[model samples]
Target: MLDFTCGRAIAVARNEKLQPELLKVGELASRAGVTVRALHHYDRIGLLKPSARAASGYRLYDRADVARLHQVQALRRFGLPLAEIGVVLDQPDTRFAGIVAEQITALRRQIAQASALRGQLVQLQRQLQLGAEPDLANWLSTLELMGAYDSYFTKEELQRLPFFQFDSQRDGIWGRLVARIAALMAGGVPAASRQARHLALHWMRRLERDTAANPDFAIRMGALMEGEPSARQRIGITPELKQYVIDALAENRLRIYANYLDADELRRMREHGGKHGKQWMTLIAAVHQQMHAGAAPGDPAVQALTREWFALFRQGAGDNPATLAKMRLAIDSEPALLAGSWINAEMLAFIRQSAATLQAPR
Candidate 1:
């Protein structure tokens, strides 16, 4: 048998606008479905201070206290610590919407981590079920290997990684691009060839879009590839292809009025490259130079380059519909660009109009 007394008391408290003059600690706790000690702790922390104290020093909660307690419980569900909850609730300017947004982000990260762990566990289970001598040694080694790769990214960085969905209508254009690049590397294709230069341009454009969407994209990518010698070795990007990308980027850098490595810097870079597997270093240097070029502020050439890039993105709509949609949304949503240039209202309005036209049903 369950007592209806607490429910009735809460109903009364909820329905009535009047602040209760006094509430027995036990009764309040029963109505709130929490321990009396929990209520006491809330009061002690100045989170839910009672409206009044009786002669016997008993706590008496009011309507304001009930509201504050409700907020505390909601924040608790977000996994916020008691101390942090207090800070959040006490903040005068923090809106409920902001708190909700933060909680949503945290929930997404927790879900992603849980999903990764579940996948790993399922793999281990399958191995055991196969009657393969489930070597605890190998299992531990595998976990360590995974941890090393995962540790390169912070939780936030991992969340920001680009996720492109395959569209059947496009016939898996992105997958084809990946395969083409892999094949080019495998076939020892010259980087400076027309095909190789086109591929390099594709890669750079993709990278630029990614970096524009996620300011931390480059940082996270660098971290992920850091110290992963096997990964670079397996890719086997040839010297010719690397030089091709370097040359293409150098041309683009000049076009955008952006500086590439100076003679001394290039010499030092090449020297450093020679010491530590020059091929990967060269590719990385080319990408970095392109980034530097794109980073220049307030140059008319840079603005023209941006417009040209956007034009290229518009053309991509027919070739890669899913990517085009995403790019359109990002261009429309992102508030600013590389340097502090506010995306002008006229530009945004034009984008919206163009997007609508592009999205219209045939």
Candidate 2:
């Protein structure tokens, strides 16, 4: 606090005897662990100019300058840029506690981060010291993958993901899956077929399991894949491959839907789905949410969700008995036919049961 304000006035008024103890710039730089050039630059920047001049015209810094320099160095160690340091020093009216408190907060964060890093290094060293041999190439690959994850995942998310925390053969499993899919593509397997669809389902299930069924983490991962193409590339999932896989799943779902209803039904559904996409999204999200909350098919909330869903369906697919019958059959046939995600076997059964109960005599 004294370094920031009227301490200089007090010192000048009462400490004239200390004037003889002033040190030249070279001596001050030596004592302060800063370079003479740095001292001159500080003076040039009006940050820490010396207060005295000797008979030889050399710059002399007194105890007050040392106090000011100490504050400057403290801020420097906190990783603030020199320009910001100058602002803090020049604004004498600025509260000293605020400035130091900010630095203290930042330093504590930095110290925690450094400590985490030290823990990792120690763990690695302990493994080596215990004769756990490492492979050079694998270690580098791990580091590269780790950095890519850092670009997208938070600490909590990484902790939950199998790719970061679990010691399993999942990476090899993924590689084999990718290679098999590539082979199928080479053989000209249509993306809209049951075989390809099932593969896509497997792919999605594996990823969902890896994320521990955390829908939020899955959403974040999808955003990362969409927003950070380079990250996908590093992980060997190129944009073309990613689009092909996504299209495969989507087209397969539509194909399954068309198996019960006509192609025109799916076509009109897509068109109307575009116009009323937001409402559909909201409805689907609510249904999925209720499912996660342990609401059963007959729960009032779930019945309400199905009511909205059924109304939306009727709005798109006309109320003709045969048409409605086929739509119901489609809902019965395959869960993938539904538009929203996680509308798997259990969710589809629940949805159909709710729709049936709502439409029954009540």
Candidate 3:
């Protein structure tokens, strides 16, 4: 009980050798590039607390505490909130490993987003390099609309659309067709009238061309026009006008087909057409595009398409040559059918040549 200062001094000397180096709040803040107040706040929030106290009752951070502070800073750089950082740190080693993997995935996503943005900027730069004036306002609006398009169509779908094709003639045709339709509407021409039927044929041709005759694409375009107010307003195809076209087309097609097929034949034709119409449109459009691009009927690509076209035809028309002949007769006799359909005389001739090419001895 008496004279214990020497023993206490010896104990302190031994402990000093075993203990790790510790830092005060100010020292840690200075070395770690944070504020002392931030350390204090971390302590209050149970995020980072000192392990020991000095003889003067000041907080002292050990090496482990400094390591934790490093981790917190790293997470902060990654945009993690302090509360989330605390939870991440407090997790068991296995869970912490999973969080590290999540961080890696998030970083990759950020890199991908950055790359996509860079691509867009590069495209704009190329446009400018090609002697096009850089209209900043128009570019900004275009980018905004592109984002809007993203919500409606996938990247691949947008790439396939006529928007990227630069067909001024096609666009001009569309403009004039729309103008004609507008004038007819203004004149109070009924949708069932002869003028409306003619307009419907033009409308179908334009629609098929614009969509490349992909029914899915056309459906998506319709959905976009219906769902997006900006698209509807810009195109000026109001729902009423759209409905009028649909009604007129349906009536017109029925009137054209009724001339050739008896009741039973008409029923089977309707069923077959309904089942395979979209695929037929897509194939026809592909062939039409190839012909327009000046591909020869004997070209390998065209021949491949021709084989598919014949296979699809047999599937629809069956093995009965009579049915095929009758349908061909109807098409050959009716001008309106050709007007209302993609199977015009030129297209039919192209298909026939492709068929002969496929049959000729190689």
Candidate 4:
């Protein structure tokens, strides 16, 4: 009888060993991508209690317990509160289908949000490819400002905008330049002072480099700053700074003209420039647009622009050959003068070629 009882006990032990496997809390937490503490919390809350306890008083999780834990995590990710998750799990019936539908809707929303985020990242990547080199802080700030940019620019325009083309070297230079100007202002330096004039020329050159490919960029940027207070604050260009820069630029121009113009010529050029400044701005914008679009100098559109350009140039230079020659020399010799006018040698060559084509015998 003793032998038979021992044999039955051994058989029972073998059968228990052949049963389904169970996992300790640590093992289950690792497998489910949750923390052991989180599992303990779930157990304490009766949300995902283990199915069995070992003789050593340790909690052990069976397959069903793991499946329930997965459900709880899924509901949590769907933004369901733990209390609500337990209630939802308890009512695993036709109502469960409704819950699943809600989860699907939530997942769809998450996917759409993720896609939009991905699109912004792609846009930033393109900006980087185009020569923007923002560091971590600036990169995060740029991401934050992407939505703000949408209110002011179209997607295509944003793609072409060089607003984000700020490398550390240029950023450092700009910071120093602004600081120097602020110092001059604080020290009571007149805008017409040589020091201010020099800094103003530097400012114009930097702005020209930023907006050279698109003349309308400067106008739109002004509009953006005027319309968006946050943008002004972010860029650190207050209204006072803007006016100071403008005054300094005017002085810089005066100095340039004085080098090449008599009193009478200066008076005439100033009048002509003021009278037709808007028209000149319009023409320059058109020429830049055409150039950016790859329009050849001989294109009919370019020929028309060339005609308008020469007409405006003659007016602004006082329609005198010698004055025109002097103005041309000033422009050619002075980088600051070119920056002020938003015209480069390449643009001039394009316009000149178009003028030659226009003057060619038909």
Q: How do the residues 1-362 of candidate 4 rate in per-residue lDDT, one tens digit apiece? A: 01112221111122234234567677667767889999999989999998876656667776678767767877888788999999889874725456567778767656755765675577679878989774575555545565677877776676456564434566578778888988998899999899998888888778767654566876676677777666765566788887788778776786798899998888876666646655776788899989989999999899988888887777766667788878878877877776666778999888888878878311
List the candidate 3 regions with Cα displacement exceeding 4 Å.
1-199, 205-229, 233-247, 314-316, 340-343, 359-362
TM-score each candidate. Answer: 0.42, 0.46, 0.41, 0.54
Q: Candidate 2 — which residues are off by over 4 angstroms? A: 1-160, 183-190, 193-195, 266-286, 291-321, 335-340, 345-362
**What value of lDDT does candidate 2 attain over all alpha carbons?**
0.68
Q: Is candidate 1 or candidate 4 better by lDDT?
A: 4
List clashing residue pairs in candidate 3. Answer: none
lDDT by candidate, in order shown: 0.52, 0.68, 0.70, 0.73
lDDT tens string, model 2, 187-257?
88877766777777777777767766655556657666667655465456666666567667666666666
Query: If ranked by lDDT, best first, what sequence of candidates would result?
Result: 4, 3, 2, 1
Worst 10 residues of 1 by lDDT: 335-344
lDDT of 1 by residue, 1-362 (tens): 12333443321243333333346678778867889999988888787788776555667676667767767876898789999999988889857766567777777767766765776576678887997666675556545544555666555555555421112323245446556866766687765456765676666656545444443455444444455544333333344444555554443322222123335433433333223223323333333343445543234443443444344433423334444454344444543221211124453444344334444321
2 versus 4: better TM-score goes to: 4
lDDT of 1: 0.52
Per-residue lDDT, model 3, residue 329, is 82
Clashes in model 1: which pairs? 191-241
**Candidate 2 lowest-lDDT run of ten:** 4-13
What are the candidates' C-alpha RMSDs?
A: 13.8, 12.7, 17.0, 15.3
For all candidates, the clash counts are 1, 0, 0, 0
